[model samples]
Target: MALLHRAEIRPTKLELLSAWLPGRPWFQGEAAAGVERVAAYRFDDPAGQVGIETLLVRAGGGPVLQVPLTYRGAPLGDAEAWLVGTCEHTVLGRRWVYDACGDPVYAAALAGAVLAGAGQAEEYFEVDGHREHRPPSMVLTVDGAWRATAPGLGAIDRVEDGDPTRIVTDAVELAVVRHVGTEPGPAGARLSGTWDGQPAPLPLASAAPR
Candidate 1:
């Protein structure tokens, strides 16, 4: 389960994303005209140390881009180059945010979810000492020989940034769909999901031998 706070964040996630997205080599078009977060999904970190979230944002009527991110209590020293920006979380204090592709925790969680046919985590909003239930924004399923493994199975060996972000892990290779498309993906697709408003399920990532 994921618990969320209604507290305010200076330099909101969208604000930070707007400035950072345009600079990404894989990010096409402009975010300067503003962007809207169409939907989002979360995956749990088994160790409970990291926060994993994937945002679907649309800017200037362009394609809905997939932006996977990881939030941590401390800086990721080795992934400084992939840092999105630090933010002050109202309840969690200072947080270090980075692109999910560079975070081992996220890569592992995503691979695990795909192999296990898992969906977005259950969410709850923490209010004045009370918790309010919320529905997940995404629905995911899986197919193929990909099976769930012990924690930390998918250790990233390398990353390639293009229209699709390819992450090479010890167990498998993942092509994370950065730009939403209607076309189906290659064979051995271990992951498929539907965005909040999209009716047809689309392959979010395809898994294959590394």
Candidate 2:
């Protein structure tokens, strides 16, 4: 489960993404007009430390781009190259946000979800000592059953930021789909999602043992 606070953030998620999206290798075209939300989902950190969220957005009417992000209270050591920038959180103070592709915590979580066929986290809003349920913007499902498998999910062994960013762990490799409606992907377990405009299931990420 994931907890949320009713707070405002400076340099909103979209605002920061607008300036960062165009520079990415996976970005198809210039985002002069910025990006708009297509769908979003979250995964929980077992230690309850980092905030893990993935956003799917469209720029200049182009393909939907999947961007996984991890938010922390302090800077991640030697990860300046992966930093997406920082923002002020009303409740949590300042946050250091990074591209999840480079964050080890996200690497472990992503592999765990794909191999185990886990779904997105449930959300709850916290306010004035009360908790309220909040429906997610979209829903995600896996292609197979929950098969227990342990992949070497320690440090990131490699990362290639192609159209489909390939992330490698010690024992697994995951192809995170950058463009929603692209190729079917390599043969393996996959994560698919559907939202308002997107009624049919769409591939979001694919995983295979390495």
Candidate 3:
């Protein structure tokens, strides 16, 4: 379960992404404009140390892009290139945000979700001390291969930039489709999802061994 606090964040998520998205080599859009948050999904960290989220946003009526992000209390070393930017959280103080492709926690979470068939974390909000459950903005599915567990998600060995952000770990390789499509593709294992208002399942990712 994911508990969300009603707190303010300086330079809201869209503001940060607007400035960061265009600069990415894989972003084919000419310029990011009218960026809107279509839907988002979350993954829980077993240790409860990091905040994992994947945002599906559209800019200027262009293609929907998948932006996976991780929030941490401190900066991640050797990830300066992947840094989206930093923001101040009303409840959590300063936060370091990065593109999830390079974050070990994100990789591990994806691995666990794909191999173990784990769904997105359920979200809840606290209002006047009462907790209310809310449906997740996005729903995801995983299939193929009965090996529902990786030995252990190893350190990130490499990351390749492309339509699908490919992450290689010692145990497996996961591809997060930067530009999601309605049509499904071949894969040893697959992860697909539907946005809040969209009924058709969109392919989100695929996984295989290195």
Name model 1 segments beyond 4 Å from true: 148-154, 182-186
**Candidate 2: how large is its RMSD?**
1.5
Stretches off by above 4 angstroms in model 3 are 30-32, 148-150, 182-186
CA error at residue 137 for candidate 1, angstroms: 2.0
Candidate order by decreasing TM-score: 2, 3, 1
lDDT of 2 at 165: 86
Candidate 2 versus the native: TM-score?
A: 0.95
**Comparing 1 and 3 by lDDT, which wins?**
3
Winner by lDDT between candidate 3 and candidate 2? 2
Backbone clash count, each prediction separately: 0, 0, 0
TM-score pick, better of 2 and 3:
2
Candidate 2 local distance difference test against the native: 0.85
Best by lDDT: 2
Residue 136, candidate 3: alpha-carbon lDDT: 79
lDDT of 2 by residue, 28-86 (tens): 75578898988899998889999999999888868888999999999999888889999
Please, what are the lDDT tens digits per residue for candidate 3 over residues 1-210?
Answer: 777889999978888998999888767554736578889999998889899999998888678899999999999988998899999999888999999989998998887787677778888888889989988778888877446454476777888877788888787888888887833233667888987677988889877765
Q: Candidates' TM-scores?
A: 0.91, 0.95, 0.93
